[model samples]
Target chain A: MTVQTWTYILVGITFALYIGIAIWSRAGSTKEFYVAGGGVSPLANGMATAADWMSAASFISMAGIIAFAGYDGSVYLMGWTGGYVLLALLLAPYLRKFGKFTVPDFIGDRYYSKTARIVAVFCALIVSFTYVAGQMRGVGLVFSRFLEVDINTGVIIGMIIVLFYAVLGGMKGITYTQVAQYCVLIFAFMVPAIFISIQMTGNPIPQLGMGSTLNDGSGMYLLDKLDGLSTELGFNEYTDGSKSVTDVFMITLALMVGTAGLPHVIVRFFTVKRVKDARKSAGWALLLIAILYTTAPAVSVFARTNMINTVSDQEYASMPAWFKTWEKTKLITFEDKNGDGKIQYVADAKQNELTVDNDIMVLANPEIANLPSWVIALVAAGALAAALSTAAGLLLVISASVSHDLIKKVFKPDISEKGELLAARLSAVVAVVIAGYFGINPPGFVAAVVALAFGLAAASFFPAIVLGIFYKKMNKEGAIAGMVIGISLMIFYMLKFKFGIFDGGKSAVAGLQKDWWFGISPEGFGSIAMLVNFVVSIVILQFTPAPPEDVQEIVEDIRIPSGAGQAVDH
Target chain B: MSDKQKKASAYWRENVRYLFLLLSIWFAVSYGAGILFKEALDTIQIGGFKLGFWFAQQGAIYVFVILIFVYVRLMNKLDKKYGYNE
Candidate 1:
């Protein structure tokens, strides 16, 4: 079959599997809907969490970023994975013990203030919506490229499929679907990497192939070859330090904390039965995630080396078929800046030949290596799995924040369980529509916007949640002020650089050396925002009285793994 | 001491200390060796990969996975000791 036909079939089969799973696992009660009835096997929960965490950015854009950025891209790998450690150690178990359906529920109860809960709800919405838009856009891009549809139509089709499973199965249905997605995404990612690794180094294992000597007998390691080629072409060395020390440290720190703080990820811990199970599931999830994360750097190095060697010295008119195909998709463009037919792929600031989108590296790698049509088709399926699984997880968080946190807790405590479930489904549909709109017309690259989402989550929600569990004296006023101030500072810094607010016009920020504070880039400013939140919270709490006696009791109850009665009913 | 009581507190304390030590190593590798003193470490190389680059891209992640496996094994022992075995 043609690549397009194969893509259609693979994607069609995936959709059928997800819908079937949803139908089979349809939740019958509020408990099942919210937390899968707390019956999910630790292994199954681990798989689902892996799928939920690895969004379109991870599947579609991460390798591409590493391919182009070389050593600099390590910030993403370290930050994203390290955050999991923080989550497992510092947050997940206690939150699971608290046994709440939504993050805001924990914050509200812990702080004993309605305003704190409302602030948390708003923060969750902003982070989830911003992150979801990127996932929806990823879905659209995959469909548009492989299925020959417009991006918007692709997004709507994905929306319909997701809505079917998400509304019907709730958390239970989404959990099983995520397991299937994890399979598809990982298989899609590894197949290409294995092919390229064998071709380049005669080693089938991509991770091992990365450090092995090249088969060409050039007396150089694979990474060394890549470093040489990249620097020769005016790019930084493939494995050298390029970013400022402080910026890299801060960005990695922010992303790590942000990953740990994301409510959607933390909520997955609630699906297991006990605190020990929560910890075990975290270990399993990291094991699964590491299989892919470790392989990504290898893929990045191989793709970069292969691309440079193939194209750098070639005449522009003789560019390869893969180049032409990608150029047609607008992912790889030839600027002809020097007006020469021979393309000079070099690292020189002025002599770069191909203006490639880093997002396309992983997707286009199969084509670059001349892999079979089926592998390309598998990539299309993989991208959908990554995007849809994450979109489903984010939508769940948004709906729960509205229905569980705002409506049930604040406005309508008298609502029935059935009424609450319906409200959650309705709110999920609304979130999907809003996310779909932005996905079709993305304002920025997938990875960049996702980093911003992380920044917001880290700055606002993380400190408050961490303090709530660890500090018994933290008060309601302190929690609300911290969240508001944290979120506002993050937004201000992001808008000033992203929208050129400080440059007096809608142009990119000028004089990077002069504009940024303490030489920290926008991506790194999240650590600063989080620091501000922690200090503000502690300082404010000293003036405010401790939480009421009842709240302290709740805190004590949440700390113990046992003797907390079964999870509270919605 | 009671069989259940003997193992529970002892095992739990041991597991916590192990986690603390492992996490400290994780912090040092990624945040310290890779980022803070990266310039110094970059001067060293292994198999054509700079030392700092190796830590950031490959070494730290490999260590993280190993750490998790280590934790799992330790926790399993603790669970058995506490008579919480499934």
Candidate 2:
């Protein structure tokens, strides 16, 4: 069978498995819909969280970013993975103890203010939407490549699939489906890496293969060759740090706090039955996620080395079939800079002008390594799994924010349970549609928007949740003001850098850019926003009265693991 | 021993301090030694690998996994001492 046909068959089988899991695990009540009845095993929750956490960006774009960015890409590695540590240490157990269906619910009750709930809802929507759009685009890209459909049609199909499962199963369905996705994605990612590693280094383990000597015995390590190739092509050596120290520090901090703050990730903790279960699940989830995170840098190094050795200094017409295929997809393009038919991939920045999209690196890695067509098809399936799993998780959060937090809590407290469930499903459909639209016409790269989503979440929701759990004195005014300032500053900073809207004209900030405070990129500014929120909350609380005495008792109760008789009905 | 007195606070404190020390090492390897001070460490090579490069791409992640397992073992011991064993 042709590679395209094999890809279609494998992908179709994976889709059937996911839909089947969702159908089997369909939620029966509002409680099940929101928190999967708080009965998920830590092991199962770990798998689901891994699938949800490793989105299209991790599966498809991360290796590409690492391949091209060289040492600079460590920001993503450290930032993304380190966030889990923060989540485990600082956020997950307390949030699980709070035992609410959604993040907005926790903020609303903790702050004891309707306005605080609304502010939380706004932040959740912005963060979830920003993140979901990237997932949709990932699904569309995979569909376009493997299924031979236009990107728009692929996005629409993805929307339909997500809507069917997410609306039908809610958290219960999404959780089980995400587990299946984790299996498919991880298996697919590893197969190609293993094959390429053995082919290049005779090492069966990709992680070890990265540091092992090459097969040719050129008296040089694999990394040494990569460093030489990259520097020769105007890229920094793979191991050398080129970014300003402050930028790396800020970005890593931002990602760590942002990961800890993301509503979708935190909500997963709530699905567990006990605080200890939540903690165990966090550890397991990090383990599963680390498997991919650790392998990505190896993949990046291998792909970069292979690309330069194969393509640089070769005639344009002699480029491999994989190059031609990727070029046809508009993912890999050559401008013929200096009108040289002989492509020069060299250390001169001017000559290294081959415009390669970062998203295509992992997607094209199998082709680059001359792996079997089945492995290529598996990668396409894995990318879809990563994107679709995350999209469902984010969509669920959006729906819950609207139906549970907004309509049920603020607008119509008297709504029936059944009515609320229907509302949640309807809102989920709306969110999917909006996300699908953005996917078809993506405003930016998957990583950038994802970073912005993290920034917004970190700024607004993380501080409030953390303070509410750890500090008893934090009151309504403090929580509300902290979220407001945190979210506003984040938005203002993002807009200033991303669009240059406040600098009077696009050209004004183009040459003389000064938006970032002390050389911090907008992506890394979330840590600052989070700190601002924390400081503001503490300062404001000193002036305002403490939370009611009953609130302090509730705080004490949440800190302990036991004596919570039953789940409180919000 | 009294119920509260049976649990040695020193054991928990020592374990937590160890976890902190290990985690600090992890942070230094990835963020400090690997990213910030990479150029300074580039002058040194270990086993044909640049010292800083090895830390950034490989060393820190390995340490993080090790730290987690170490913490888990310590926590189990702490739970036993506190009579909160699961």
Question: In terms of DockQ, which candidate is strongest?
Answer: 1
TM-scores of the models, in the order given: 0.95, 0.94
Interface RMSD of each: 2.7, 3.0
Q: lDDT tens digits, residues A1-570, model 2?
A: 778998989989998998898899888888889888888999999999999899999999989988888778888887777777667756776677778789888888888889999999999998999899989988988999888899899999899999989999999999999999999999999999999999888888888888888988775789888877777666677776667888888887788778888989989988988766777888789889889988998899889889888888889999888888778889888867888788876656677657678988898889989888999999999999999999999999999999999999999999999999999999998999899889888865445667678788889988898788767788999999999999899888877876567776545655434646887888888889989999998899889988998887677556554433324566
**Worst ten in a row by lDDT for model 1 chain B:** B4-13
Here, model 1's chain A TM-score works out at 0.97
DockQ (model 2, Cα): 0.33
Model 1, span B7-85: residue lDDT tens: 5446545756876887898899899887887778989877756788888988888777677667667666766666554
